[model samples]
Target: MESPKRTRNGADVTNAAMLVDHHCHLDFPQFAEDLDGIIGRAKAAGVGTMVTISTRIRQFDRIRVIAETYKDVYCSVGTHPHNADEELDIPVEDIIRLAQHPKCVAIGEAGLDYYYQHSSAQGQAEGFRRHIRAARETGLPLEIHARDADEDTATILADEHAQGAFPAVLHCFTGGRDLAMRAVDLGLYVSFSGVVSFKKSEALRALAAELPLDRILVETDAPYLAPVPYRGKTNEPAYVVHTAAAVAEARGITLTELAAATTENFFRLYTKAQPPEELDPSLLKGAPPQ
Candidate 1:
Protein backbone atom coordinates (compact mmCIF):
# COMPACT_ATOMS: atom_id res chain seq x y z
CA MET A 1 0.00 0.00 0.00
CA GLU A 2 1.16 3.50 -0.76
CA SER A 3 1.40 5.87 2.18
CA PRO A 4 0.00 9.37 1.87
CA LYS A 5 2.39 12.32 1.63
CA ARG A 6 1.63 15.38 3.70
CA THR A 7 2.69 18.99 3.99
CA ARG A 8 4.22 20.58 7.08
CA ASN A 9 0.72 21.50 8.17
CA GLY A 10 -0.40 17.83 7.89
CA ALA A 11 -2.80 18.01 4.96
CA ASP A 12 -2.94 14.85 2.85
CA VAL A 13 -1.05 15.34 -0.45
CA THR A 14 -0.99 11.89 -1.98
CA ASN A 15 -3.58 11.01 -4.62
CA ALA A 16 -4.87 7.75 -6.06
CA ALA A 17 -7.92 6.16 -7.58
CA MET A 18 -9.68 5.34 -4.32
CA LEU A 19 -12.91 4.94 -2.40
CA VAL A 20 -14.62 7.59 -0.29
CA ASP A 21 -15.73 7.27 3.32
CA HIS A 22 -18.87 9.38 2.87
CA HIS A 23 -19.57 9.55 6.61
CA CYS A 24 -17.19 9.57 9.59
CA HIS A 25 -16.36 11.54 12.75
CA LEU A 26 -12.76 12.68 12.48
CA ASP A 27 -13.44 15.44 14.99
CA PHE A 28 -14.23 12.90 17.68
CA PRO A 29 -11.77 12.66 20.57
CA GLN A 30 -10.95 9.06 19.65
CA PHE A 31 -8.82 10.47 16.80
CA ALA A 32 -7.34 13.41 18.75
CA GLU A 33 -3.94 11.81 19.27
CA ASP A 34 -3.34 10.48 15.74
CA LEU A 35 -5.55 12.38 13.36
CA ASP A 36 -2.88 12.90 10.74
CA GLY A 37 -1.79 9.27 10.94
CA ILE A 38 -5.39 8.18 10.47
CA ILE A 39 -5.62 10.27 7.31
CA GLY A 40 -2.35 8.82 6.05
CA ARG A 41 -3.44 5.23 6.65
CA ALA A 42 -6.69 5.92 4.83
CA LYS A 43 -4.72 7.15 1.83
CA ALA A 44 -2.55 4.05 2.01
CA ALA A 45 -5.69 1.94 1.95
CA GLY A 46 -6.97 3.79 -1.15
CA VAL A 47 -9.59 5.98 0.50
CA GLY A 48 -8.99 9.26 -1.29
CA THR A 49 -11.73 11.31 0.32
CA MET A 50 -13.61 11.53 3.62
CA VAL A 51 -16.53 13.56 4.94
CA THR A 52 -16.41 13.90 8.73
CA ILE A 53 -20.03 14.19 9.86
CA SER A 54 -21.42 16.55 12.50
CA THR A 55 -23.42 15.32 15.49
CA ARG A 56 -24.21 18.77 16.85
CA ILE A 57 -24.71 22.11 15.14
CA ARG A 58 -22.93 23.96 17.99
CA GLN A 59 -19.76 21.90 17.48
CA PHE A 60 -19.58 22.49 13.72
CA ASP A 61 -16.56 24.75 14.07
CA ARG A 62 -14.48 21.84 15.37
CA ILE A 63 -15.65 19.70 12.45
CA ARG A 64 -15.05 22.55 10.00
CA VAL A 65 -11.48 23.03 11.20
CA ILE A 66 -10.75 19.36 10.61
CA ALA A 67 -12.08 19.66 7.03
CA GLU A 68 -10.08 22.85 6.49
CA THR A 69 -6.90 21.20 7.80
CA TYR A 70 -7.15 18.17 5.54
CA LYS A 71 -7.41 18.96 1.84
CA ASP A 72 -9.15 15.68 1.05
CA VAL A 73 -11.58 16.01 3.92
CA TYR A 74 -14.99 17.70 3.93
CA CYS A 75 -17.81 18.04 6.48
CA SER A 76 -21.55 18.45 7.07
CA VAL A 77 -23.61 20.72 9.36
CA GLY A 78 -26.66 19.87 11.54
CA THR A 79 -27.70 18.25 14.81
CA HIS A 80 -27.88 14.50 15.19
CA PRO A 81 -31.20 12.99 16.29
CA HIS A 82 -29.71 12.47 19.75
CA ASN A 83 -28.82 16.16 20.03
CA ALA A 84 -31.97 17.45 18.34
CA ASP A 85 -33.56 18.79 21.51
CA GLU A 86 -30.49 20.83 22.42
CA GLU A 87 -30.34 22.47 19.01
CA LEU A 88 -34.06 22.82 18.36
CA ASP A 89 -33.85 26.58 18.74
CA ILE A 90 -31.30 26.73 15.93
CA PRO A 91 -33.12 28.30 13.02
CA VAL A 92 -33.05 26.97 9.48
CA GLU A 93 -31.21 30.10 8.37
CA ASP A 94 -28.38 29.26 10.75
CA ILE A 95 -27.98 25.79 9.25
CA ILE A 96 -27.94 27.33 5.77
CA ARG A 97 -25.41 29.97 6.76
CA LEU A 98 -23.12 27.45 8.42
CA ALA A 99 -23.22 25.20 5.34
CA GLN A 100 -21.69 28.04 3.28
CA HIS A 101 -18.23 27.13 4.55
CA PRO A 102 -16.21 25.90 1.53
CA LYS A 103 -15.36 22.61 3.19
CA CYS A 104 -18.90 21.99 4.33
CA VAL A 105 -20.66 19.96 1.64
CA ALA A 106 -23.72 18.25 3.15
CA ILE A 107 -26.64 19.32 5.36
CA GLY A 108 -27.00 16.65 8.01
CA GLU A 109 -26.70 13.36 9.84
CA ALA A 110 -30.18 14.23 11.08
CA GLY A 111 -33.35 12.11 11.30
CA LEU A 112 -35.31 9.97 13.77
CA ASP A 113 -33.65 7.53 16.17
CA TYR A 114 -36.48 5.86 18.10
CA TYR A 115 -33.97 3.23 19.18
CA TYR A 116 -32.22 5.68 21.47
CA GLN A 117 -34.91 8.36 21.76
CA HIS A 118 -32.50 10.62 23.66
CA SER A 119 -34.47 13.45 22.19
CA SER A 120 -38.26 13.53 22.02
CA ALA A 121 -39.80 12.16 18.79
CA GLN A 122 -41.32 15.55 18.11
CA GLY A 123 -37.96 17.27 18.59
CA GLN A 124 -36.23 14.85 16.24
CA ALA A 125 -38.93 15.29 13.59
CA GLU A 126 -38.74 19.07 13.84
CA GLY A 127 -34.96 19.06 13.51
CA PHE A 128 -35.12 16.58 10.65
CA ARG A 129 -37.60 18.74 8.76
CA ARG A 130 -35.47 21.84 9.37
CA HIS A 131 -32.41 20.09 8.01
CA ILE A 132 -34.43 18.83 5.07
CA ARG A 133 -35.45 22.40 4.26
CA ALA A 134 -31.82 23.45 4.55
CA ALA A 135 -30.93 20.75 2.06
CA ARG A 136 -33.78 21.80 -0.21
CA GLU A 137 -32.68 25.43 -0.07
CA THR A 138 -28.93 24.92 -0.20
CA GLY A 139 -28.95 22.28 -2.95
CA LEU A 140 -26.59 20.23 -0.81
CA PRO A 141 -27.19 16.60 0.02
CA LEU A 142 -28.65 15.79 3.42
CA GLU A 143 -27.01 12.90 5.29
CA ILE A 144 -29.89 11.26 7.13
CA HIS A 145 -29.43 9.06 10.20
CA ALA A 146 -32.39 6.77 10.78
CA ARG A 147 -32.59 3.90 13.25
CA ASP A 148 -35.67 1.84 14.25
CA ALA A 149 -37.75 4.74 13.03
CA ASP A 150 -38.08 3.77 9.42
CA GLU A 151 -41.80 4.47 9.13
CA ASP A 152 -41.55 8.00 10.44
CA THR A 153 -38.35 8.69 8.51
CA ALA A 154 -39.96 7.56 5.28
CA THR A 155 -43.16 9.46 6.04
CA ILE A 156 -41.31 12.72 6.76
CA LEU A 157 -39.13 12.29 3.69
CA ALA A 158 -42.23 11.75 1.57
CA ASP A 159 -44.11 14.66 3.12
CA GLU A 160 -41.17 17.06 2.91
CA HIS A 161 -40.17 15.86 -0.52
CA ALA A 162 -43.71 16.37 -1.68
CA GLN A 163 -43.16 20.02 -0.79
CA GLY A 164 -39.86 20.14 -2.76
CA ALA A 165 -37.30 17.65 -3.99
CA PHE A 166 -33.92 17.77 -2.30
CA PRO A 167 -30.66 15.96 -2.73
CA ALA A 168 -30.11 13.56 0.19
CA VAL A 169 -28.81 10.16 1.25
CA LEU A 170 -29.68 7.75 4.05
CA HIS A 171 -26.41 7.40 5.92
CA CYS A 172 -25.52 4.14 7.69
CA PHE A 173 -28.74 2.50 6.49
CA THR A 174 -29.89 -0.48 8.60
CA GLY A 175 -33.57 -0.24 7.80
CA GLY A 176 -35.71 -2.90 6.14
CA ARG A 177 -36.09 -3.53 2.37
CA ASP A 178 -39.30 -1.52 2.23
CA LEU A 179 -37.65 1.63 3.60
CA ALA A 180 -34.61 1.20 1.37
CA MET A 181 -36.78 0.84 -1.72
CA ARG A 182 -38.98 3.73 -0.66
CA ALA A 183 -35.92 5.94 -0.19
CA VAL A 184 -34.66 4.99 -3.63
CA ASP A 185 -38.12 5.52 -5.07
CA LEU A 186 -38.05 9.01 -3.60
CA GLY A 187 -34.79 9.52 -5.55
CA LEU A 188 -32.62 9.39 -2.43
CA TYR A 189 -29.44 7.37 -2.02
CA VAL A 190 -28.88 4.67 0.63
CA SER A 191 -25.43 4.28 2.19
CA PHE A 192 -24.20 1.04 3.68
CA SER A 193 -21.73 0.85 6.53
CA GLY A 194 -19.58 -1.75 8.35
CA VAL A 195 -22.77 -3.22 9.76
CA VAL A 196 -23.48 -4.69 6.32
CA SER A 197 -20.28 -6.68 6.58
CA PHE A 198 -21.30 -8.50 9.75
CA LYS A 199 -21.99 -12.24 9.77
CA LYS A 200 -25.50 -11.72 11.09
CA SER A 201 -26.20 -9.13 8.40
CA GLU A 202 -27.20 -11.63 5.74
CA ALA A 203 -30.44 -9.79 5.12
CA LEU A 204 -28.61 -6.49 4.84
CA ARG A 205 -26.17 -8.00 2.38
CA ALA A 206 -29.09 -9.29 0.32
CA LEU A 207 -30.55 -5.80 0.26
CA ALA A 208 -27.19 -4.39 -0.83
CA ALA A 209 -27.25 -6.86 -3.70
CA GLU A 210 -30.75 -5.72 -4.67
CA LEU A 211 -30.49 -1.93 -4.49
CA PRO A 212 -29.93 -0.08 -7.75
CA LEU A 213 -26.21 0.37 -8.42
CA ASP A 214 -26.44 4.13 -8.93
CA ARG A 215 -28.11 4.68 -5.56
CA ILE A 216 -25.79 2.49 -3.49
CA LEU A 217 -23.01 4.03 -1.32
CA VAL A 218 -20.57 2.82 1.32
CA GLU A 219 -19.27 4.38 4.58
CA THR A 220 -17.51 3.42 7.80
CA ASP A 221 -19.47 5.50 10.35
CA ALA A 222 -16.05 5.19 11.80
CA PRO A 223 -14.67 5.31 15.29
CA TYR A 224 -17.85 3.17 15.54
CA LEU A 225 -18.77 0.13 13.40
CA ALA A 226 -15.45 -1.26 12.17
CA PRO A 227 -15.80 -4.01 9.49
CA VAL A 228 -15.01 -7.72 9.98
CA PRO A 229 -11.21 -7.73 10.26
CA TYR A 230 -11.25 -4.66 12.47
CA ARG A 231 -14.63 -5.48 14.04
CA GLY A 232 -13.68 -4.74 17.63
CA LYS A 233 -11.14 -1.98 16.96
CA THR A 234 -11.69 1.71 16.40
CA ASN A 235 -12.52 2.32 12.72
CA GLU A 236 -11.00 5.06 10.55
CA PRO A 237 -11.38 6.02 6.89
CA ALA A 238 -8.90 3.23 6.04
CA TYR A 239 -11.39 0.58 7.02
CA VAL A 240 -13.85 1.87 4.42
CA VAL A 241 -11.95 -0.22 1.88
CA HIS A 242 -13.01 -3.35 3.75
CA THR A 243 -16.60 -2.21 3.71
CA ALA A 244 -16.29 -1.47 0.00
CA ALA A 245 -14.76 -4.88 -0.58
CA ALA A 246 -17.63 -6.47 1.29
CA VAL A 247 -20.21 -4.57 -0.72
CA ALA A 248 -18.43 -5.40 -3.95
CA GLU A 249 -18.27 -9.10 -3.14
CA ALA A 250 -21.91 -9.08 -2.18
CA ARG A 251 -22.69 -7.41 -5.50
CA GLY A 252 -20.38 -9.77 -7.41
CA ILE A 253 -18.11 -6.99 -8.58
CA THR A 254 -14.42 -6.15 -8.15
CA LEU A 255 -13.14 -3.67 -5.57
CA THR A 256 -11.99 -1.33 -8.34
CA GLU A 257 -15.47 -1.34 -9.87
CA LEU A 258 -17.05 -0.66 -6.47
CA ALA A 259 -14.57 2.14 -5.80
CA ALA A 260 -15.31 3.78 -9.13
CA ALA A 261 -19.08 3.50 -8.77
CA THR A 262 -19.36 4.67 -5.14
CA THR A 263 -16.87 7.49 -5.56
CA GLU A 264 -18.87 8.67 -8.55
CA ASN A 265 -22.07 8.28 -6.54
CA PHE A 266 -20.53 10.34 -3.72
CA PHE A 267 -19.53 13.29 -5.92
CA ARG A 268 -22.88 13.15 -7.64
CA LEU A 269 -24.73 13.62 -4.33
CA TYR A 270 -22.11 15.86 -2.71
CA THR A 271 -21.95 18.31 -5.60
CA LYS A 272 -20.42 20.96 -3.33
CA ALA A 273 -17.32 18.84 -2.68
CA GLN A 274 -14.56 19.13 -5.27
CA PRO A 275 -12.16 16.35 -6.10
CA PRO A 276 -8.57 17.00 -5.03
CA GLU A 277 -6.56 18.42 -7.94
CA GLU A 278 -3.82 15.93 -7.25
CA LEU A 279 -6.22 13.00 -7.53
CA ASP A 280 -5.26 10.42 -10.15
CA PRO A 281 -7.99 10.35 -12.78
CA SER A 282 -7.09 6.75 -13.58
CA LEU A 283 -8.44 5.65 -10.24
CA LEU A 284 -11.90 6.65 -11.28
CA LYS A 285 -11.09 5.29 -14.72
CA GLY A 286 -10.84 1.83 -13.17
CA ALA A 287 -7.20 1.58 -12.09
CA PRO A 288 -6.65 -1.75 -10.38
CA PRO A 289 -7.48 -1.72 -6.69
CA GLN A 290 -4.53 -1.56 -4.30
Candidate 2:
Protein backbone atom coordinates (compact mmCIF):
# COMPACT_ATOMS: atom_id res chain seq x y z
CA MET A 1 0.00 0.00 0.00
CA GLU A 2 2.99 2.31 0.37
CA SER A 3 3.89 4.79 -2.40
CA PRO A 4 7.11 4.34 -4.28
CA LYS A 5 9.96 6.31 -2.74
CA ARG A 6 11.63 8.90 -4.96
CA THR A 7 14.50 11.31 -4.62
CA ARG A 8 14.25 15.05 -5.07
CA ASN A 9 15.19 14.54 -8.72
CA GLY A 10 12.43 11.90 -8.99
CA ALA A 11 14.86 9.06 -9.53
CA ASP A 12 13.60 5.62 -8.55
CA VAL A 13 14.28 4.78 -4.94
CA THR A 14 16.42 1.84 -6.05
CA ASN A 15 18.98 4.17 -7.63
CA ALA A 16 18.59 7.10 -5.26
CA ALA A 17 18.85 5.52 -1.85
CA MET A 18 21.61 7.32 0.04
CA LEU A 19 24.36 5.55 2.03
CA VAL A 20 26.59 6.63 4.85
CA ASP A 21 30.15 5.24 4.98
CA HIS A 22 30.18 5.72 8.73
CA HIS A 23 33.85 4.80 9.18
CA CYS A 24 37.03 5.54 7.17
CA HIS A 25 40.33 7.37 7.57
CA LEU A 26 40.32 10.26 5.12
CA ASP A 27 43.46 11.66 6.77
CA PHE A 28 45.62 8.73 5.68
CA PRO A 29 48.35 9.57 3.19
CA GLN A 30 46.91 7.20 0.57
CA PHE A 31 44.20 9.78 0.02
CA ALA A 32 46.55 12.79 0.04
CA GLU A 33 46.87 13.08 -3.74
CA ASP A 34 43.28 12.49 -4.78
CA LEU A 35 41.33 13.59 -1.73
CA ASP A 36 39.03 15.85 -3.71
CA GLY A 37 38.38 13.16 -6.29
CA ILE A 38 37.77 10.65 -3.52
CA ILE A 39 35.07 12.75 -1.92
CA GLY A 40 33.60 13.54 -5.33
CA ARG A 41 33.41 9.84 -6.25
CA ALA A 42 31.84 8.97 -2.92
CA LYS A 43 29.12 11.60 -3.40
CA ALA A 44 28.54 10.48 -6.95
CA ALA A 45 28.20 6.89 -5.75
CA GLY A 46 25.42 7.92 -3.32
CA VAL A 47 27.53 7.94 -0.15
CA GLY A 48 25.81 10.92 1.47
CA THR A 49 28.11 11.15 4.47
CA MET A 50 31.47 9.86 5.75
CA VAL A 51 33.19 9.81 9.09
CA THR A 52 37.00 10.07 8.96
CA ILE A 53 37.83 8.16 12.14
CA SER A 54 40.75 9.16 14.35
CA THR A 55 43.33 6.46 15.19
CA ARG A 56 45.39 8.68 17.38
CA ILE A 57 44.18 11.45 19.65
CA ARG A 58 47.28 13.54 18.92
CA GLN A 59 46.37 13.70 15.23
CA PHE A 60 42.75 14.62 15.87
CA ASP A 61 43.22 18.16 14.54
CA ARG A 62 44.30 16.79 11.15
CA ILE A 63 41.33 14.41 11.13
CA ARG A 64 39.00 17.21 12.18
CA VAL A 65 40.32 19.40 9.37
CA ILE A 66 39.37 16.77 6.80
CA ALA A 67 35.82 16.69 8.16
CA GLU A 68 35.75 20.51 8.17
CA THR A 69 37.03 20.68 4.58
CA TYR A 70 34.02 18.76 3.24
CA LYS A 71 30.44 19.49 4.29
CA ASP A 72 29.46 15.83 4.11
CA VAL A 73 32.43 14.58 6.09
CA TYR A 74 32.58 14.12 9.87
CA CYS A 75 35.24 12.78 12.30
CA SER A 76 35.63 10.80 15.52
CA VAL A 77 38.01 11.25 18.49
CA GLY A 78 40.10 8.53 20.26
CA THR A 79 43.23 6.43 19.83
CA HIS A 80 43.24 3.16 17.93
CA PRO A 81 44.21 0.08 19.95
CA HIS A 82 47.45 -0.25 17.98
CA ASN A 83 48.59 3.12 19.30
CA ALA A 84 47.17 2.66 22.78
CA ASP A 85 50.55 2.53 24.47
CA GLU A 86 51.74 5.75 22.90
CA GLU A 87 48.67 7.61 24.12
CA LEU A 88 48.35 5.78 27.43
CA ASP A 89 48.73 9.02 29.33
CA ILE A 90 45.79 10.67 27.54
CA PRO A 91 43.00 11.01 30.06
CA VAL A 92 39.28 10.55 29.56
CA GLU A 93 38.82 14.25 30.26
CA ASP A 94 41.10 15.16 27.36
CA ILE A 95 39.18 12.88 25.03
CA ILE A 96 35.91 14.40 26.27
CA ARG A 97 37.30 17.88 25.59
CA LEU A 98 38.37 17.04 22.04
CA ALA A 99 34.98 15.46 21.35
CA GLN A 100 33.26 18.80 22.13
CA HIS A 101 34.14 20.10 18.65
CA PRO A 102 31.03 20.35 16.52
CA LYS A 103 32.63 18.24 13.81
CA CYS A 104 33.57 15.44 16.24
CA VAL A 105 30.77 12.85 16.20
CA ALA A 106 32.03 9.65 17.93
CA ILE A 107 34.58 8.66 20.56
CA GLY A 108 36.68 5.84 19.25
CA GLU A 109 38.08 3.17 16.95
CA ALA A 110 39.37 1.90 20.29
CA GLY A 111 39.23 -1.64 21.77
CA LEU A 112 41.51 -4.70 21.64
CA ASP A 113 43.80 -5.71 18.79
CA TYR A 114 45.68 -8.79 19.91
CA TYR A 115 46.47 -9.70 16.32
CA TYR A 116 49.50 -7.42 15.95
CA GLN A 117 49.98 -6.55 19.56
CA HIS A 118 51.35 -3.21 18.38
CA SER A 119 50.54 -2.00 21.85
CA SER A 120 50.73 -3.96 25.07
CA ALA A 121 47.51 -5.63 26.18
CA GLN A 122 47.46 -3.72 29.44
CA GLY A 123 47.90 -0.39 27.70
CA GLN A 124 45.22 -1.21 25.13
CA ALA A 125 42.82 -2.21 27.89
CA GLU A 126 43.53 1.00 29.81
CA GLY A 127 43.08 3.14 26.71
CA PHE A 128 39.91 1.29 25.78
CA ARG A 129 38.39 2.06 29.16
CA ARG A 130 39.34 5.72 28.80
CA HIS A 131 37.56 6.01 25.44
CA ILE A 132 34.48 4.31 26.90
CA ARG A 133 34.36 6.83 29.74
CA ALA A 134 34.62 9.63 27.19
CA ALA A 135 31.78 8.10 25.16
CA ARG A 136 29.63 7.86 28.28
CA GLU A 137 30.39 11.47 29.20
CA THR A 138 29.82 12.93 25.72
CA GLY A 139 26.82 10.76 24.80
CA LEU A 140 28.57 9.87 21.53
CA PRO A 141 28.98 6.40 20.10
CA LEU A 142 32.30 4.58 20.28
CA GLU A 143 33.77 2.93 17.18
CA ILE A 144 35.36 -0.29 18.46
CA HIS A 145 38.11 -2.19 16.67
CA ALA A 146 38.46 -5.80 17.82
CA ARG A 147 40.85 -8.15 16.07
CA ASP A 148 41.71 -11.64 17.38
CA ALA A 149 40.74 -10.46 20.83
CA ASP A 150 37.04 -11.00 20.74
CA GLU A 151 36.76 -12.56 24.18
CA ASP A 152 38.58 -9.70 25.89
CA THR A 153 36.74 -7.16 23.79
CA ALA A 154 33.37 -8.63 24.74
CA THR A 155 34.37 -8.89 28.36
CA ILE A 156 35.51 -5.26 28.41
CA LEU A 157 32.35 -4.22 26.64
CA ALA A 158 30.17 -6.15 29.10
CA ASP A 159 32.09 -4.83 32.10
CA GLU A 160 31.95 -1.30 30.76
CA HIS A 161 28.23 -1.54 30.04
CA ALA A 162 27.64 -2.68 33.61
CA GLN A 163 29.26 0.56 34.79
CA GLY A 164 27.35 2.72 32.32
CA ALA A 165 25.84 2.17 28.90
CA PHE A 166 27.49 3.92 25.98
CA PRO A 167 26.55 3.79 22.35
CA ALA A 168 29.06 1.91 20.18
CA VAL A 169 29.58 -0.26 17.10
CA LEU A 170 32.09 -3.02 16.42
CA HIS A 171 33.55 -1.63 13.20
CA CYS A 172 35.17 -3.84 10.55
CA PHE A 173 33.85 -6.91 12.33
CA THR A 174 35.65 -10.15 11.34
CA GLY A 175 34.78 -11.91 14.55
CA GLY A 176 32.80 -14.99 15.55
CA ARG A 177 29.02 -15.23 15.97
CA ASP A 178 29.37 -15.16 19.73
CA LEU A 179 31.14 -11.80 19.71
CA ALA A 180 28.66 -10.39 17.21
CA MET A 181 25.71 -11.49 19.36
CA ARG A 182 27.46 -10.26 22.50
CA ALA A 183 27.77 -6.80 21.00
CA VAL A 184 24.16 -6.88 19.88
CA ASP A 185 23.07 -8.07 23.32
CA LEU A 186 24.74 -4.98 24.77
CA GLY A 187 22.61 -2.79 22.48
CA LEU A 188 25.62 -2.01 20.29
CA TYR A 189 25.88 -2.23 16.53
CA VAL A 190 28.07 -4.36 14.22
CA SER A 191 29.52 -2.80 11.07
CA PHE A 192 30.66 -4.75 8.04
CA SER A 193 33.41 -3.64 5.73
CA GLY A 194 34.88 -4.87 2.40
CA VAL A 195 36.05 -7.95 4.29
CA VAL A 196 32.53 -9.31 4.17
CA SER A 197 32.61 -9.37 0.38
CA PHE A 198 35.69 -11.56 0.06
CA LYS A 199 35.42 -15.06 -1.46
CA LYS A 200 36.30 -16.91 1.75
CA SER A 201 34.09 -14.86 4.04
CA GLU A 202 31.07 -17.17 3.98
CA ALA A 203 30.98 -17.28 7.77
CA LEU A 204 31.17 -13.49 7.97
CA ARG A 205 28.47 -13.11 5.33
CA ALA A 206 26.35 -15.60 7.28
CA LEU A 207 26.86 -13.57 10.43
CA ALA A 208 25.94 -10.40 8.60
CA ALA A 209 22.76 -12.08 7.41
CA GLU A 210 21.96 -13.18 10.96
CA LEU A 211 22.29 -9.77 12.65
CA PRO A 212 19.19 -7.69 13.21
CA LEU A 213 18.89 -5.06 10.46
CA ASP A 214 18.49 -2.18 12.88
CA ARG A 215 21.68 -3.13 14.68
CA ILE A 216 23.81 -3.40 11.55
CA LEU A 217 25.95 -0.76 9.79
CA VAL A 218 28.28 -0.63 6.77
CA GLU A 219 31.62 1.16 6.31
CA THR A 220 34.61 1.23 3.97
CA ASP A 221 37.55 1.43 6.42
CA ALA A 222 38.99 2.85 3.26
CA PRO A 223 42.53 2.93 1.84
CA TYR A 224 42.29 -0.63 3.28
CA LEU A 225 40.19 -3.79 2.79
CA ALA A 226 38.93 -2.81 -0.68
CA PRO A 227 35.96 -5.09 -1.63
CA VAL A 228 35.89 -7.71 -4.42
CA PRO A 229 36.62 -6.71 -8.06
CA TYR A 230 38.66 -3.91 -6.51
CA ARG A 231 40.21 -6.21 -3.93
CA GLY A 232 43.86 -5.35 -4.55
CA LYS A 233 43.18 -1.67 -5.17
CA THR A 234 42.98 1.04 -2.54
CA ASN A 235 39.49 1.15 -1.02
CA GLU A 236 37.39 4.29 -0.82
CA PRO A 237 34.01 5.44 0.40
CA ALA A 238 32.56 4.92 -3.08
CA TYR A 239 33.21 1.18 -2.82
CA VAL A 240 30.96 0.96 0.21
CA VAL A 241 28.18 0.31 -2.29
CA HIS A 242 29.81 -3.02 -3.14
CA THR A 243 30.00 -3.88 0.53
CA ALA A 244 26.37 -2.87 1.01
CA ALA A 245 25.37 -5.01 -1.97
CA ALA A 246 27.13 -7.98 -0.42
CA VAL A 247 25.37 -7.42 2.87
CA ALA A 248 22.02 -7.02 1.16
CA GLU A 249 22.48 -10.23 -0.79
CA ALA A 250 23.48 -12.00 2.39
CA ARG A 251 20.36 -10.76 4.14
CA GLY A 252 18.05 -11.46 1.19
CA ILE A 253 17.22 -7.77 0.82
CA THR A 254 17.72 -5.11 -1.81
CA LEU A 255 20.52 -2.55 -1.70
CA THR A 256 17.99 0.24 -1.09
CA GLU A 257 16.62 -1.55 1.95
CA LEU A 258 20.13 -2.18 3.28
CA ALA A 259 21.14 1.42 2.63
CA ALA A 260 18.10 2.83 4.37
CA ALA A 261 18.53 0.54 7.37
CA THR A 262 22.24 1.20 7.75
CA THR A 263 21.95 4.96 7.19
CA GLU A 264 19.25 5.07 9.83
CA ASN A 265 21.49 3.01 12.11
CA PHE A 266 24.40 5.39 11.51
CA PHE A 267 22.34 8.44 12.43
CA ARG A 268 20.92 6.63 15.43
CA LEU A 269 24.39 5.90 16.79
CA TYR A 270 26.32 8.97 15.65
CA THR A 271 23.59 11.37 16.75
CA LYS A 272 25.78 14.46 16.23
CA ALA A 273 26.32 13.99 12.48
CA GLN A 274 23.41 15.65 10.70
CA PRO A 275 22.06 14.25 7.46
CA PRO A 276 22.24 16.50 4.41
CA GLU A 277 19.19 18.77 4.22
CA GLU A 278 18.50 17.78 0.61
CA LEU A 279 18.11 14.08 1.47
CA ASP A 280 14.52 12.80 1.22
CA PRO A 281 13.61 11.91 4.81
CA SER A 282 10.85 9.55 3.68
CA LEU A 283 13.40 7.18 2.15
CA LEU A 284 14.65 6.46 5.68
CA LYS A 285 11.26 5.99 7.29
CA GLY A 286 9.71 2.93 5.55
CA ALA A 287 10.23 0.07 3.16
CA PRO A 288 10.64 1.20 -0.46
CA PRO A 289 8.16 -0.04 -3.08
CA GLN A 290 8.62 -3.68 -3.97
Can you list the residue pairs that collide in candidate 2?
none
* Residue range 68-130, candidate 2, lDDT tens digits: 999989999999999999998887899999999999999988999999999999999999999
lDDT of 1 at 92: 98
Shift of residue 247 alpha carbon in model 2, Å = 0.3
lDDT score at residue 120, model 2, on the 0-100 scale: 99
TM-score of 1: 0.92
The per-model lDDT (C-alpha) reads 0.87, 0.88
Q: Where in model 1 is the C-alpha error above 4 Å? A: 1-17, 278-290
Give the runs in model 2 whose Cα sits over 4 Å from its true position: 1-16, 286-290
For the record, the alpha-carbon RMSD of candidate 1 to the native fold, in angstroms, is 6.0
